[model samples]
Target: MAASLFLARRSLRLPFPRIVRTSKWCGVPALGVHTTAGRMNTNQQDFEKSQNDLKILKKDPGNDIKLKLYALFKQATQGSCNTPKPGMLDFVNKAKWDAWNSLGSLSKDEARKSYVELVNNLVSSEAPLKDSASLSTREQYDTLQVVSEDNITKIFLNRPEKKNAITLQMYEEIGLALDEAAKDDSVITVLTGYGDYFCSGNDLNNFTSIPPEGKEKMARDSAVILQAFVRKFIDFPKPLIAVINGPAVGISVTILGLFDLVYATDRATFHTPFSQLGQSPEGCSSYTFPRIMGLSKAVEVLLFNKLLTAHEACKLGLVTEVFTDGTFQKEVWERLRAFGELPKNSLAFSKQLIRETEKEKLHAVNVQECERLRERWLSEECMNAIIRFFQKKAKL
Candidate 1:
């Protein structure tokens, strides 16, 4: 929702994680050299362990559990919900279909992570999910990894193979994650991505997958979603941080304006190619970018589709600091963990003081930008540009 570009979806597939399945996962450490094999190995290890643990459970985990596990297994083994929906009268498969389909466009890796984390929780003699505050704790995210520890709530955009692109479902999930983080006890919140890329941009499938007659509705709805997403940032009470582990694009880059701190790796680059995609800036970038950088520099980025290296963005005040890629995560997260130990209400109050005066202006800019984007989504220019993008992509 915070993106600028309407980029093509990554058509490539990652090799399946061997023995991948569902279990609960949390406390995700900062990623280091997140190669394909390393990710597969970690998830596979958890999968095997959870399966072994599942075999020894004395009691059945119940129908709901069965459906969740089945759905997760399908998601982990296959990808997304590409299967046909079950007929309504067929209660059993219908329930299963509903369960699986609810995952939306969740990538297989994220589904595997969710599956592993859920299974781990269920294996517990006292499952936190059963008759407890499961909404904040046990409910598995389809496209994100969220955990609160060390007084810091960390939200990871968990789609690595697609370079952490923001799918339509991911947009919703991120807003929800931020909502939960805001209400939680954590003194600070951190946002980053899984694997290689911070985020490429909004998946253009959000636009291309429109129903035959739904383009108008889709555009309007997307504008509303984007508006709300930016509102979450504007109104967030706690200190929000962005840990830019790698290259960031689209909303991922633009939305840094709303964050309290943006720590990036030397490898990170910031890009917002809105004009190239026939889109306008969302995330209040129109207003904030000019304020953060000069109007001239902001125009270079928002209009001319400029790409900024981490150091360049830092120099422009868009990023707080840039660390060498070798120690980026270690150094940034160490400081964040320490910062999270600060007095909670004081941090929140201080952040509110910093953001309160501009909250109204930010909200207005979000509305204005989303309105422009809504128009762009249906424009002839945008349609032609998108068609050209897909055509070029198909050849690749």
Candidate 2:
């Protein structure tokens, strides 16, 4: 299924007119030509062009292509990959880290040249460019509505009847949306729910669907995907803002800690019931919540299973602001659109500066948290807790 999704996404790429901006990089020559342009440093041009090419890619690239892009981008921008490879169990991060590191001593200029050539080849072979809105609207998953307009990408959780309860497929779609946002420099992402509830967290059916004896494989795969999703949020280059239109529960609440800004309606509430569910924290909330709200507050949410009102969450530093329920969406969109209008590169660079110091630590915590959560998911306590939860819900 994963492989098929990969192929589907990659199958269509719109041919884009060559647009390169001029900038200087460490002693690289400025080039002028049809595909290449004037005043831009060769390396910088390649880097920007590669980013543009990535934006047009209909799907996430294969691991090899992704690794090459990661390595080349890092080489061109940061000179080398300094972070250590993630632990083996963290297959995704390790693959990414290793890919960047594999460039070894490759010069920035050479990396830039190779990157530009690769993108040029891909662009030449792909489909003609379509409207940006068309690309964003093309892949509509059952549970997500991804709309990109005026430099803002809004992802609406669409399962109102289910209180927007998330399934594995929803996770995949959200991850893909994030991937697309990452590639497009102009887009700032906003996450919200379609109806009254932001999300009720993981769909219980997702848990019950796994066969009892063969659950390990499913659990492992889920852990990888979930961790990858959270990691994408952690490492998202552009601004990510969450508009909490209503209540959010479990992983939904935990994810708020990772957003650049969070706005909630007056009637909105937040809860992380990891302890109540006999689950350890996911989403690296263990690390991020403490950093954002202090250890005591983090414990209150994770260990004590406290529900936080929007005002209370704002007071605790989890929410950026709260708007009246009637005007919530309007106000949030107004702010997001204003934010989107600001100088794009400045926002990106500032975000990068704020995040750089903690990047490695966040990845480490994510690895640790996922491992512990995997253990908890398989525990007898968690099994009993699940049975009890459904039984209580059934009675209600």
Off by over 4 Å in 1: 1-138
The most accurate candidate by TM-score is 1
The models' CA-based lDDT, in order, is 0.74, 0.68
Instruction: For candidate 2, give the lDDT of residue 312.
Output: 94
Q: Which stretches of candidate 2 lie over 4 Å from their true place?
A: 1-136, 211-213
Model 2 scores a C-alpha lDDT of: 0.68
Candidate 2, number of clashes = 2
Compared with the true structure, what per-residue lDDT tens digits does model 1 show for residues 212-268? Answer: 767788778878888888899899899999989678888888889999999997878
lDDT of 2 by residue, 260-336 (tens): 89999787888776666677887778888888899998898888888899999999999999986534555567678
Give per-residue lDDT, candidate 2, residue 110. Answer: 73
- The estimated TM-scores of all candidates read 0.68, 0.65
